[model samples]
Target: MLKGKPKYKAIRILEGCGFHAQMGLEVLEQRSLINTSPNGYLDMHDHIEEMGRNIACRLHPNEPNKRRRLCDKEEIEEVLVNDLGTKATRIMNLKNPSIHPATIIEKLRKMKALELLSVYDADRVSQNWVFDEDVQYFPDTLRSLHWTGYPASSLPKTFQANDLVNLEMTRSCISQLWEDGDRKVE
Candidate 1:
């Protein structure tokens, strides 16, 4: 009922509402798909139903009961097979709080959706995982990253390696090096 340029405020409120509604739609769509009759007995309807329940729980308005459910192997397989398609393989690479790489890869390969490559690291879960010199399939975006736990092998390969040459080889090395440089100037 307020007046004078409430367009921005109205837009914000409407956008927020739309976002939640969109999420609910996705949940409903997934639910409908899960309820659809499977092609065969091995169609994993039980697993799909569980995943749909989890999704519904997450999108529920009850904040106290909205705790995100960690997906298991069966749930991951069902979602990958029935929901995400090729994007499922990419998402499989993500570090799930509760799921296994073998489980994901097994289903993906069985579905002929992804090729299991021995070249890739299976246990690579953390965002801080190290890369070796032989790593060939790394993303180009990773090259310019400034993460705290930079790989020791890659350190010498970066522009910042020159800083190591300035380091002194002793206890209180940094302070001692500064003092030494000051004395040399005087």
Candidate 2:
């Protein structure tokens, strides 16, 4: 843990050792001690919305925070839209078991900069759901998609994002990733 005032010299020294102290001295000074461990340290410049999304994505049912009632969807959306100007690129764990899948889909469709989407159903089983809209509604910049309990029988015909690198769907009804037989898989 870093204690005391983190002056410019201290910041530089930490940086020289491959540690980042980008939060600046004023912010660091407010904390009595800063833990530099991997899980303890977080970039101050990182959007809280993004961080919350990640937390929700990685949240385990048995985690202590879950019992404390940490899920607050409205607050997360507010920070994502108001504070970060809706600039989130990676979205994960936005689905909570209690919330309906349709609502989650609607929320995802509106994210302008969303590049990575990871969703899980808390029910532990696949539910039949369909996205009736064209795949073009999804951001072309999307690179990774992980959806648990996906309800569709096949991937959207309009899904042609060239930037996509990872796709995972568990407990899904998908029979094929695309309709075009001519498309090559590399």
Question: Superposing all C-alpha atoms, what RMSD in Å does each candidate have to the true structure?
Answer: 19.6, 12.2
Cα lDDT of candidate 2 equals 0.49
Q: Which stretches of candidate 1 lie over 4 Å from their true place?
A: 1-49, 52-88, 93-130, 136-186
In terms of TM-score, the best-performing candidate is: 2
* Candidate 2 segments exceeding 4 Å error: 1-89, 95-97, 134-136, 179-186
Q: Which candidate number would show the highest lDDT if scored against the true structure?
A: 2
* TM-score between candidate 1 and the true structure: 0.19
Q: What overall lDDT goes with each candidate model?
A: 0.28, 0.49
Cα lDDT tens digits for candidate 2, 39-60? 4332333364455445654644
lDDT by residue (33-104, candidate 1, tens digit) is: 422123211122466656665674565324311223313444444553443333222112222223333333
The deviation in Å at residue 10 for candidate 2 is 31
Clashing pairs in 1: none
Clashing pairs in 2: none
On a 0 to 100 scale, what is the lDDT of residue 20 in model 2?
A: 68
